[model samples]
Every structure is written in C-alpha cells, then in structure tokens.
Target: MADDPTKKGPADRTRVSTSEAHELRYWSEKFGVSHDELKRAVAAVGNSAEKVEAYFRDRSRDARR
Candidate 1:
C-alpha cells in the first residue's frame, strides 16, 4: 500500500457511487459517525450522497422529536 492509502487518487469519485476506503473515512469524519453508520445511510438511501445526507438529517430530526 502507498504511504498514505487514504490520500485520494486523481480518479477518486464521490463516496455515493464508489465507497472507497478513503471516501468512507472522509464521509465518516464529515458526518461525525462510524463507518457502519455511513454504510447504513448509503444502504438505506441507495448511494446518493444527497439522499444519504437527508436520511441522516431526517433520522436525527426524528430522534430529537
């Protein structure tokens, strides 16, 4: 592996379509959640970043109710 596997490559796509390890880590940090949670959101919302974000946003909103 390279010295920094998390470093994004030139072709690295968005996390939605290809949940690469680095992208997963980035999403996890960006969302302040675990990898599993991010995966769950993706799974629940079919890998659209907007949908996944909305899923979590709605989930959090529901939790606050």
Candidate 2:
C-alpha cells in the first residue's frame, strides 16, 4: 500500500463540481492557512492525515480570538 496520506485512492477521490477558486478558499479556511500557504504546506507535508488533524486543532484554538 502507498504511504502517502494525501494520495487518495480511486474511490476516495470525488468530484465536487465547485468553482476552483471557491474550493481553494474552502480548503484554506478548513486548514487554517492562506490559500497560497496551504498549497505550499500540502506540498511540503504531503497532506498527512495526522498533520491535517493537528492543523484543525491549532486553527480551532486560534478561532477563539
């Protein structure tokens, strides 16, 4: 099995049919990073599940502001 967390299997990848820009914004908000930053982070971290969860937790904490 492949070890990359970001590499979704064929069944896991779904088409959302949304605007590309909107989708990017949604991911940035969901991941708690700027659009450009998120792209870089995903590339650097390979979208590990654990990393994503940690990002969410950190973002949640910051959201209290």
Candidate 3:
C-alpha cells in the first residue's frame, strides 16, 4: 500500500481520538509493527473492523524485517 498519510479525508480524521491513538500504539508495539503499518492495515480493511483486527492478530508472529 501507498505511504500517503493524507489519504483519509478530514471527516475521517475526527473518528480517531487520543485514546484510540494510544491503543493503536500499544497494539503496534505488541504486534511488532510500525504505527504506519497498523494504519495501512486498517485502511485496507476499510469498514470491516473484524478483518482489521484479524490482520494484526494473524501477522503478529511475523518479524518486521
């Protein structure tokens, strides 16, 4: 996926909160992924929240390198 952080529109930005950011950070750390990778996975999964969660759960074992 592309690395454009601006891909999400302004309205979409409002959907995330500080707490959510912290949560994402925690998950990213636990899963051994960059925050950007977590964001990309979420974006790729779109509205499917389950798929987004599953992506992290399934990929956590893979080394980042």
Best by TM-score: 1
Worst 10 residues of 1 by lDDT: 10-19
Looking at model 3, which ten-residue stretch has the lowest summed lDDT?
Answer: 9-18
lDDT leaderboard ranking? 1, 3, 2
State residue 64's C-alpha deviation in candidate 3, in Å. 12
TM-score of 1: 0.72
Query: Per-model C-alpha lDDT, please?
Result: 0.69, 0.52, 0.54
List the candidate 3 regions with Cα displacement exceeding 4 Å.
Answer: 1-19, 47-49, 56-65
Off by over 4 Å in 1: 1-18
Residue by residue across 1-65, what tens digits does model 3's lDDT show? 23334533223332321125555555466446777886787677653446666777767647463
| Pairs of residues clashing in candidate 2 | none
Per-prediction count of colliding residue pairs?
0, 0, 0
Q: Write the per-residue lDDT of candidate 1 for residues 3-55, one digit (tens) a residue.
A: 35557641323436334676677677767788998887888778766787788
Clashing pairs in 3: none
Cα error of candidate 2 at position 3, Å: 28
